[model samples]
Target: MKKFLKVMLVCVMVLFAFTLVFGTSKKDEKEGIVIGFSNASVSNSWRVFMVANYEHEVTLHPEIAASYYTDADDKPEKQIADVDDLLVKGIDVLIISPAVQDAVNPAVEKAFDMGIPVIVFDRKVTTDKYTTFIETSNYEMGKAQGEWLAKELNGKGKIVAFSGVAGSGPAEDRWKGAQDAFSKYPGIEILGQQYTDWSPPKAKGVMEAFIQQFSQIDGIWADSGLMSWPALEALKEAGRPLVPSTGEQLNAYAKFVVKNNLRGFIYPFPAWMSRIAVQYAIKAAQGEKLPKYIEIPVDPIGPDEIADYVQMDKSDFWWVGDDQMPEEFLPSFD
Candidate 1:
């Protein structure tokens, strides 16, 4: 009887030890380094490419055991709620492209206060509570475009500007930068400036109005291909000659420039920034120290080199700057 009791006690002890070890291991496995991505919206081709790039990048890191994703549909309230929900899910890291600058501040600050590393990219929040900000300078992008246009016109022209969504950080910064450049030349006259909300249709309508308002438009300045391409189409429909313009590194814009033999400047705002953002998230999750700001470099594609960036075989919605993604992962509207 004594031997049996001793054996039973030893069995219970071993069982308890096994349960403790395996239970902790299971919990760790279930909770391993979860990442949350809160995107602003996928309303446009560029945003669609960005989300796709992020999804593909996550697959490359085996250590990233799980991920949560949310799209706010360009709504500030929805983005705030999405961030809150991600926090409740116990995510170790949060990556966000904000819908607007000031509206998402509280949610971002909360995540930072709770010790969850926050990474902001693409767009920005007003606060500096994020672990890192990854972006190519929108201001510089606009300034470069403006400077090119100014020089092309010999520091003078009757030009109209098309900006992206109003109140957006990118739009405001780019507009300001372009304005600063234009201010340097007294001969330059800005006929008008309108916000396109980054929609091709809206840009077309605005350009049509500009065409009617101004009898002579020497140059065109647009913040992105989303607007620039449609604006050009408006000019074509109106039976006006193509003018020197500035646009982004979109395949459609490049193709258009090549087909029309248009003189233009193409500065790429790469969608692959999301891929870099994911890499930073992984590093932050591993408790690595990172710089507070990471600015991806931008290079302008001149008329001489625009043909090199054109992918005639690709769909009109494709962005040329997203070469970092595999061809299979690239977004195509066709």
Candidate 2:
């Protein structure tokens, strides 16, 4: 009986040691890599689709144990705080879409300094302390749109420009590119420019004000459909003819262009780029090397190609470039 009791004591000690070793391993296995996503805002339909894409992609990666996300509601300060909060949550990788170019740089740099892999997408930060940047060329998009408008107007027209949220990377870069393009044509006269905040109501109001202020508005240079569609409506309401305009790859914009036979240029800033960002984040977490920048190519849709891209069946909020997304994730009018 004494020998048996001694044997039992030894077995208990071994079992406890086993639990401390393999049990911890099991817990770690259960909680796989964690990811943190700091989103700027879902203020527009494009951003809404982008966020949905990110969420759906996370589910596809079983190795991702958990993901934490925060929306800054378009505030750079809030975005900075959100990133800090995500970092404190012990995420293995950080993915951020900054609210503005310059204001969110410090937070991103801090994450990099902590040896955390950072993936910046859509918008960009001024600092180079990130793992990778995933984006299409906003500058090219703007330049193409401006050149198209110039050709349509025979390099001479009184044009009003509409841009997205001020100080944001895309907005600023695209504006700069468009200005550069317009500068090439000495005949192109810019009557006025306004930041539309990518809101249809606000765009409509701005367009209405432009109509009231400008006596000869010949062309409209809108960075995206968010403003172009509403601006068109404003023109119609004021009994003005629809002018040649530039917009992005939005289903509603395509449909409106096709239905109205309006001459327009559609350039895509694909929402699916968010999915690619997630792919890069997972790769970085798994100790794989990734390029510092991945530039997705974009092709502009001209008047001849507009009908092929228009999705009359889909909701107006649908972004046409989200074709790669799962059907369930696509926006619906119903």
Candidate 3:
């Protein structure tokens, strides 16, 4: 009788384990959550990384369905329409990186009113309507740039500053943070400041004009990495020495630093933006509350920090983890 009782207990445990495995099977469940992602554009490297990371999370969870919309070319109208389209699908959650803060408000507010949870990543809209905002500390990044520039120049040089797309929060905060840190040095002269509208073409024109206007331009600071690439080209074409510029365009700018044009660089927290947004959305969907402001940490792209970013000495892009590539493989993002 005792032996029979032991056999019965073993059978009971086996049955319970089978039940657990069957209950957790996603193929058997069709009523899982759907998430909608609306992006400004994936034309740039950083945005591509953001989209890839989000897609990775969706891929790992077969129970979740994701719909993606890209407002090609950073057009606000396109973004708004895209968001409306996603809303019509009745997504359980919405993820957005606005084309620009103020212009994308109506669509964001619409999603909030519908009782859909909204997660803002990287770029932000100006309303508390978003359930959470996950992005880098832009102000701190600018301050690091300021300190680096001051040290590079020995606390004295004439600087020409490039502003990107005026009134955007990141651009404005970067500018303010840099100014606040650099103002401590009285010898640093800011010859001029102007907006590039965050375009390479505009930056080219701005750089040419700066060179024409100021002969003694010793240092330059850019608020946009997208802007700096063209500016760097213009400087090379005009036979002017390149100075270190700060911006989120760290990948392209890092090549210049490695080759010696940029004395210091600031890398934006874009790739991390995706991991964070995915984690936040997953938590919120599971009934967890998040912080109102989720500021991501970032490091200035100094030579010393290169190893932490690249991980592999041979690897090319910061987004590509060392684990993704075999150690023997060549590391070239190109």
Candidate 4:
């Protein structure tokens, strides 16, 4: 009878021990920090590269137990909702690449008020409530391209300017910066300025119309490489000579510039900003001090510098990654 009682007591104690162990594990997991990303959009090749880098970056950190993300599709309304949804998941850190400056301000403030660490990147909000902001200086990039174009064209030429989606921060800043540079040279004429939505097809259409309207286009400038190759295509179809242009360090753009011996400059906007956002969020979550703003530099690639950045084997849209990324980190798109 005693032996039977001892056996029953042992079983109960063992069951209790197992329950405690599992209960503690479950609680720890629940308490783990979740990083949330509210990406502006995956609508273009640049964004796709950023997202791919972000996903890979998250996997390298074991401290980040889990992560969540939303694609806003370049809509402020969708981005606001995305932030709200991420909040519902009880995210410890909130990272955003805002679609619009004013529209995303309130959502970012709400996250800050909730005691969540907010890391804003690429695009920015009007408010100063976010913890950190990471971005390339759009104005500087545009100015560099503008100055190069001015010199290449001897400070005077009719040029077509292309920008990303209208109303976005980068588009606005780049346009303003280029204007600042071109304003110094009265001889430089802006034939037309159009929003390409950073779409090659859309840029082609806009360029086609510009070609029909103007007979003498001296040069071209774009906020990104999205319009670079298409700009070339438009000029080709119109039987116009290739002119001086500006773009990002895209594989295809580099190849095009080299093959044609075109007077083009590449002011790269590295796709690794997304990964840096994740890094900053994690550090902020870990109670580390972070700067309010981190500015990345633009590395310009001219004719002589094209060979250093071009990798023909990679996809046409692939740009250079930061040091943390492996040499082979680019996703295969071909």
Q: Candidate 4: lDDT of 99?
A: 88
lDDT of 2: 0.84
lDDT of 3 at 119: 93
Better of 1 and 2 by lDDT: 2
- Per-residue lDDT tens digits of candidate 4, residues 1-334? 2243234334433433443344345436675557888888767777766766776687677677667777787899999999999899777899898887778898999999999999998887889999998999888888888888888899999999999978788888888899999998899999999998888889899999999999999999888878977998799888998998998866677777877777778888878888889889999999898999999876688867777677766667666543346645444454
- Sort by TM-score, top down from the best: 1, 2, 4, 3
Across residues 1-334, which tens digit of lDDT does each residue of candidate 1 receive? Answer: 2243234334433433443344345447774567888888776778777876776787677666666777787899999999999898778899999998889999999999999999999987789898999999988999999999999999988998999878778888888889999999999999999998888889899999999999999989999988888888889899987888998977788888899999889989989999999999989988999999999997789999998879998878788868576766554454
How much is the lDDT of residue 203 in candidate 1? 87
> What is the per-residue lDDT of model 2 for residues 1-334, given as tens digits with 9 covering 90 to 100?
2243234334433433443343335336766677888888777778767866776676677677767777787899999999999888788899999999989999999999999999999998899999999999888889899999999999999999999999998998899989999999999999999998888889999999999998888999999998998898899899998899999987877888888899999999989898999899989989999999899998889988999988888888788868566765443334
**For candidate 4, what is the lDDT?**
0.80
Clashing pairs in 3: none
Q: Is candidate 3 or candidate 4 better by TM-score?
A: 4
| lDDT (C-alpha, whole model) for all candidates | 0.83, 0.84, 0.66, 0.80
Ranking by lDDT: 2, 1, 4, 3
- Residues 199-268 of candidate 3: C-alpha lDDT, one tens digit per residue: 6567789889988988877776777566665777787889888776665544555555555535556566
- Stretches of candidate 3 exceeding 4 Å from the true structure: 1-30, 303-334
Winner of 1 and 4 under TM-score: 1
Better of 1 and 4 by lDDT: 1
Q: What range of 10 consecutive residues in model 2 has the weakest lDDT sum? A: 1-10
Worst 10 residues of 4 by lDDT: 1-10
